[model samples]
Target: MSVATLHYIHDPLCGWCYAAQPLVSAMQAQLGDRLALRLHGGGLFGEPRRVDAALAQHIVHSDERIAQLSGQPFGEAYKQGLLADEGTVLYSLPPIAAVLAAESLDAAKAYPMLAAIQNAHYQRGLRVVEPQVLTELAEEIGLDGTHFAQALARADGHTLFEHVQASRRLLDEAGGHGFPTLLLEVDGRRTLLPHHHYYGRPDAFVQMLAGQLPAVH
Candidate 1:
């Protein structure tokens, strides 16, 4: 089978990344074995910050805009439950670390684990920055909890720093500004797929990206 790789460079905490989730899923399903997708985490909040009253409000506003534009879900739990809190600082490392861990242990689990993080954060009103929370989420998705816990705990500074560096390298190499960037790679060549259409019509988006895939005999 002829196959190509799709490089997804994104921050797990990014609103736009969450918005693009469904589209990416649809693309993978349509492409089947014709596509190989890799997930990369960009450290958007390398230096974490507490979601203060003002910042929380701003996050809600920005996420709302993303939801409207992309037709993605921004539940009341996220807007009212999570964002209403002032004590929680938003950090990107824990979730990124968890994703990398999943990728290492079982590559197939990586994207599912990421979707779990986004769902936990936006739909379930869960604070995903805590290692324990990530462990529980991974376990809930049928991943080995012990392995996940170890991975979560052992994600030392260097490990996380390397991931952040790698994320930045992919972004710079792709000439992308930031998160939720998708690149289609075939035979060592790369092309950036315009992510706008993926937000609305994923089937059409996949068709545009894959370009008239062969029919089943």
Candidate 2:
């Protein structure tokens, strides 16, 4: 039997994407060798701009809603510490490009590195815009901090742009109109898993995938 591929289309800096991380991780753990996971960068912000006050409140409220609905933890620090810092730029491209750089260095480390960045930004309230924070994360995950930094500094601008473009194309093709979408391929066919809203229990999502998949070696 051919190995199944699960493509996770998401933006690294998206709050809802952060909420979905635990479930994705759980799915990955369960599938293991039976599946291959791929990350597609969904650029939520193509252009940099200051987050408006209303927009910030909306984001925080959405996070709260997800936590309440899915039972995911959304601590006060996530909003107060991370989003409250005015100096921190809310650019999604840098971190997305950074993950691509990490993937180029080591594919296995890409997802974990991305998850770490999200945890730092959303959970731990670390400033992702700061080079020092990213560097520290790179080192923590046993990646070459210098190379990671260099790659991020000189990331293929056009390539990253193209990646976002491609992801948008794929999203359109899949009829997906949201962030944190999951596209699964099995037996040469693609299916978009329905995730109407955020989910709190990662295990439930994992079980959903396991149930959908045929029992085969």
lDDT at residue 208 of model 1 (Cα atoms) = 84
Q: Against the true structure, whose lDDT is highest?
A: 1
Each candidate's clash count: 0, 1
Model 2 scores worst on lDDT over the 10 consecutive residues at: 195-204
TM-score of 1: 0.93
How well is each residue in 190-211 modelled by candidate 2, as lDDT tens digits?
8998755427677777777777
Using TM-score as the measure, the top candidate is 1
The pairs that clash in candidate 2 are 70-200
> Local distance difference test, per candidate?
0.84, 0.78
Model 1 alpha-carbon drift over 4 Å, by segment = 212-217
